[model samples]
Target: MKENILVIGGTGKTGRKVAHKLSKNGHLVRVGSRSGSPAFDWHKPEYWSLALQGMDKVYITFQPDLAVPGALNAIEALTKQAKNANIKKIVLLSGKGEREAELCEQVIIHSGIDYTIIRASWFNQNFSESFFLEPILEGFVALPQADIKVPYVDTEDISDVAVEALLNDKHNSKIYQLTGSRSLTFKEVINEISETTGRDIAFTPIAISAYTNMMKQQEVPDDFIWLVEYLFTEVLGNPNNSEITNDIEHVLGRKPKDISEYIKETAATGIWNS
Candidate 1:
């Protein structure tokens, strides 16, 4: 059945990809961004109704992260509005290691709407589109851990899964644990990208305190630094997330895109052509 789908955080990494895939497949896509028509701002509840208007399905990707303070309340409020608007289905992009994100998922589970939760691992695009990008470009990637391995899922893969969940009701009421087919340390990931691009990039593993000081020196906002620290100290320290999952293959019927492939494609796009 054809349905109207509104993509919240439509301009973000995964949300943009989800919106594009849905649009190309002929689903009616309404972008819910602060800049979109009938702008939607999660911080401003007034715009919620306008964004939910005329939509039967919603793909909700919270900005910053769902682990941030007050996310649960906002999610509860949004789910209520979705129910009020008669929206029958909802797909949420959540983090795998976040306990707070789990709270938000519970809100959707009991919302009486068809819900799909995509609890995703770290994104492969972090090296190209996020904090790690600049460090890679600078040839000096300083991070907190050298031995910790992560199952980093690509946003493209996540987007594909998200699109499937939204357009097909088969995934309704399912919680998918999405991860890359393999796990790699941050050093290993950087090495792979360096080999792909023929760039001599080096990974400098610093202490938690040292990394914090570096961020302070660069004048990164305190809250953002706190968030990163929380992720490294709390979430990354959790060992359960180190194992890879077949959820992507289970949903998309194929092996998830590998980090090497992602690096090659990103290099071809000139985004990492340093």
Candidate 2:
């Protein structure tokens, strides 16, 4: 059956991909962004009903990290609005090792609405599409938690699972943990990118405190800096986060994209060199 789906954070990493696939599958997709029709904004609760109105399902990716302050309240409020709008199912993109993100998941679980929780490891796109890209372009990368091995999942795989969950009832009330087939450290990631791009990129391991201090010196936002520190200390520091999971394969019936494939594809885009 064709469905009307609202994709919150629709232009974001996984959200845009999910929306595209849904549209290709012949679903009515209303992208939820500040600039999108009905104009969905996380900070604006009054406008949520406009976004949710007449949507059969919603794919939600919280702006910033769900670990940030007031996220739980915002999620709770959104769930309430979803219920009011008669939204049937919601697929939430959540962090795998984040305790606070888990709390936000609970709100959806008890919302009396059908839901699928995608608990994902760190994303492979961080090195290419996010903050790490700038440093890689500059030929130097410095970060905390360099010793931790992260089984970074690709956003494409994430979107695939999300689309499946949204379109099928079998995934209702399911919680899937998504990770790559293998784990890699910061140095390993940098090495692969450097090799793939044929660029001489350097990696430096620094203390978490020192790293946050550097962000402060750069005048990065305090809340963002706080969330980064929390992720380094809380999420990456947890050893269980490194365990490779077959959740993506289980859901999509194929192995998740390996980091090498991501590196190679990204290198071809000339993003790192640019």
Predictions in order: lDDT: 0.91, 0.95
lDDT of 2 at 129: 82
lDDT of 1 at 123: 93
Best by lDDT: 2
- TM-score for predicted model 2 compared with the true structure: 0.99
Tens digits of per-residue lDDT, candidate 2, 65-102, equal 89999999999999999999999999999999899999
Models 1 onward score TM values of 0.97, 0.99
Show model 2 residue runs off by greater than 4 Å: none
Off by over 4 Å in 1: none
Q: Quote the RMSD, in angstroms, for model 1.
A: 1.1
Question: How do the residues 32-125 of candidate 1 rate in per-residue lDDT, one tens digit apiece?
Answer: 9999988999889978998899999999999788888878999999999999999989999999988889999999999899999999999999
Per TM-score, the best of the predicted structures is: 2
Q: Per the 3 Å backbone cut-off, how many clashing residue pairs does candidate 2 have?
A: 0
Candidate 2: pairs in clash: none
Error of 2 at 35 (Å): 0.7
* Prediction RMSDs, each to the true structure: 1.1, 0.6
